[model samples]
Target: MGARRRVREVRPTDGPLLEVEDLRTYFETRRGLVKAVDGVSFELIAGRTLAIVGESGSGKTVLSRSVMGLLPQRNVTREGRVRFAGLDLVGAPEHELRELWGDQIAMVFQDPVTSLNPVVRIGRQITESLRHHVGMSRSEARAAATALLRSVGIAEPEQRLRWYPHQFSGGMCQRIVIASAIACGPQLLLADEPTTGLDVTVAAQILDLLQRLQHERQMSMILVSHDLGLVAGRSDDIIVMYAGKVVEKAPTATLLSDTRMPYTEALLRSAPRLTDGSHRRLPTIPGAPPDPSDYPAGCRFASRCAYAQPRCAEEEPPLRPGAVPEHTYACWYPVGTPHGAEALELNRAGGAVG
Candidate 1:
């Protein structure tokens, strides 16, 4: 339960469908200000899926919250620009954001229980957005809601419409959330770990539904999740974040085949596979993210990076474009290729590498 912050947006842009430049979000706590997202920047094209992958507490959720304008108005402070469709969102009026939220951009949460209202009928909850945002009448919204439920694969849509959140299974509830998110025919959808806490089959179904919807609607998506496999399968591009900053960003195929960042490589290695490889221990990046209030001066990940040198502790590296051109990593010594093997050998000798 964090308080939302009111801050000004800076740096508006054009060209890309969504552009985030030097975005910073800080929370006021008793200890100090928590700089959850500091100087993160990226772009998403229309109708393309950008998967944001990171470990827990890496500011993945915070960035999404900032984009959605969900942060509280109290002690939180936000700087930088979040421009979508040529409009700056940093200090956008609430009424303007409300008009866009359901019609232009929608969000699907990981947990269905908290997202849906218990007292309202599932039908009303899904249809309400259409009525408010699209100006659909009661009867029209209900019909549209029923069609949406069926489209999302919910069984017996008519009967289920009358039921409350308590009656549905986790998967069913998630489907309802998806239905609601799509009810307004939005152009951009922000799904925060949409498949978390569900059975593998159900999770796959949810992802499949999203892909189909995106294709049919020509919708763009910002998928926030830790599951590398899901991102690899569903996303066109991947953005790897660590300690409130992007370490690597590239096309998914490029990233999976040739990860240019040590952190991204570690994440790929840590993924569970069905293959049998004896004595090959699961790789893991050692140490947790530094407390935002007391982040290390140089690289936020320097304390855990295997390639860290004395300079790494003293100076932060700039995020530069990699060999592939579009792929970028923020490291003085980007991993992979000629220098990577020697680095891996050194790490093996010291037993500090993932």
Candidate 2:
């Protein structure tokens, strides 16, 4: 008789702070169903950072919105599990989720000006969450708000708290947003390009502040950015998304030094490096990503992939570990390193995938 199949242990309790399992979000558009987030999955451990790197329309923003329960309910559909601190966010009750929202998790969006209310005082906005979530009295909330502003490196916190959103510069508004996000000391922080509109110098300062805060609070963060350099420097784990799916995920050093997936490699090659000398043409990915409504069957990147084979258009590959457990990629024909590496030698010297 054949041996009994091994039963995989179902241990949701042992999962990380947030575990996104086969999550998908679809939009019912007039043209057709747009699978904005198609079966993307990753885990964010406590006190660590996971950077979701992708180009625009790659479902990076949508995925973050779905987790935060911010999407419009009329035409949006979400599937699969988002287990956070043992609670299922996808189907959790609204009131309970609201209670958990600010204290357990909070978000700092890409654009601070758009996110902040122009008519409202910064102090009121910050204290509102404190009053609602922590049941603080108005005076106590105001005091806390002032402290938060100071904590995020805002000068003249007392005076700044009375000003409206529009009175502050873009960088100041972003700092206000960050201050409010950390008011309750949330265990999870979702920063979606939190430095998006700020100048380069200000952006660096903001990132430095965030990293310092994370270290002090030991908070888990999911940083969504289009900048590969940002991810390479800040994240412990890197997940590369293309056409609403994760093509590769690996430790930061491994992914940067020896990217396996073609899409990931292309993204790295296209990034501007300080080392690159003056050149007329910069390296770039050849084609645009597929339209969500009509993604190719086998590989979403096959159309743009430099090493596309007949099989690439015929079969989809499951995301699995590369060489070891922390490094994973989804491609039949991944790329190789410039110098000899294990993953590189495997792909270049042998016909392993065939």
lDDT of 1 by residue, 92-192 (tens): 99988987787788999999888999999999999878888767778877788889999999889988999999999998999999999998888789999
Per-residue alpha-carbon lDDT of candidate 2 for residues 67-148, written as tens digits (9 for 90 to 100):
8887887888899999887888998878867777777888999999999998998999888777776767778787888888
Each model's lDDT comes to 0.86, 0.84
Candidate 1: regions farther than 4 A off: 1-14, 346-354
- Candidate 2 segments exceeding 4 Å error: 1-14, 337-354
The TM-score of candidate 1 is 0.93
Ten contiguous residues minimizing lDDT sum, candidate 2: 1-10
Q: List clash counts for every candidate, in order.
A: 4, 0
The C-alpha local distance difference test score for the whole of candidate 1 amounts to 0.86
